[model samples]
Target: MSLANHLEELQRKHGDIERQIDIALSHPSIDDLEIVDLKRRKLAIKDEIEKLKASPTTH
Candidate 1:
């Protein structure tokens, strides 16, 4: 797939993670470790998106 398509997929995953985080937070029995892992994954995806955006060919 092209860089643009890859970026879009990553963004969609990131949004899905955000939704999961929200749902987890809404639960009274949510595990803190799980939430932290989810947040870390989300940040990683965001960082990747930024790196892709910064690539010369992406422009």
Candidate 2:
């Protein structure tokens, strides 16, 4: 896949994770660890996006 396409996918994943976190927060029975894991995954995706954006690319 192209770098642009990959980046777009990562962004989509980040957004999805954010939504998951929101939904998870709404339920009192949800495990805190699960939420934390989701947040970490989101942050990791965000970091990857930033790294890709920071580097000069044709995309």
Candidate 3:
């Protein structure tokens, strides 16, 4: 896939993670560790998106 497509997909995943985190926060039954993991995954995806945006390549 092209870089733009990849970035778009990453952004979608990040948004989905955000929604999951929100849902997890709303429910007391959700485990703390699960929320933490979701946050970590979200952060990682954000970092990746930033990295891709900063890169010079168009691919």
Candidate 4:
């Protein structure tokens, strides 16, 4: 796949994770560990997106 396409997919995944975190937060019996894991994954995806955006090919 092209670099742009890969980056888009990663961004979509990051958005999905954000929604998941929101839903988890709305729950009455939310699991702290689960939310933490989701947040961590979201951050990792964000970092990867930034890295890809910085690549010469992406520009």
Candidate 5:
């Protein structure tokens, strides 16, 4: 797959993770660890997207 496609997928995954975080927060038993992990994943994906945007593309 192209790098742009990969970045798009990562962006979608980040959106899903954000939603999951919101849902987790609403629950009475908030999984703090899970929330933190998801946030970390989101940040990682964001960083990846940024890198993809900055990098030059062939096509």
Candidate 6:
């Protein structure tokens, strides 16, 4: 897939992960480690998206 499409998919996945984290926190038990891992993944995806946007596009 193109960079734009990849970014969109990343954003969508990030949103889904965020919601999952929210729900996990609301429960009687919360996994801080899991949340941390998810946050790290989200940040990585954002970084990749930024890099893709910055680089020159090729046809």
TM-score top scorer: 1
Candidates in order, TM-scores: namely 0.97, 0.94, 0.96, 0.95, 0.87, 0.77
RMSD in order of candidates: 0.5, 1.2, 1.4, 0.7, 1.7, 2.2
Off by over 4 Å in 4: none
Q: Alpha-carbon error at 27 in model 4, in Å? A: 0.4
Lowest lDDT 10-mer window, candidate 5? 50-59
Cα shift from native, residue 18, model 1 (Å): 0.1
lDDT of 5 by residue, 1-59 (tens): 97868978998999999999999989969879988998999899899888888877723
lDDT of 6 by residue, 1-59 (tens): 87778879988887887888788778757778988887888788778767877888822
TM for candidate 1 is 0.97
RMSD score of candidate 5 (Å)? 1.7
Q: What tens-digit string does per-residue lDDT give for candidate 4 at 1-59? A: 98889999999999999999999999969899999999999999999999999988776
User: Residue 55 lDDT in model 1?
Assistant: 90
Q: Write the per-residue lDDT of candidate 2 for residues 1-59, one digit (tens) a residue.
A: 99999999999999999999999999999999999999999999999999999888944
lDDT per residue as tens, model 1, 1-59: 99989999999999999999999999979999999999999999999999999999987
| Residues forming the 10-long window of minimal summed lDDT in candidate 2 | 50-59
Q: List where candidate 6 sits over 4 angstroms from the true fold.
A: none
The list of candidate 5 runs beyond 4 A from truth reads: none
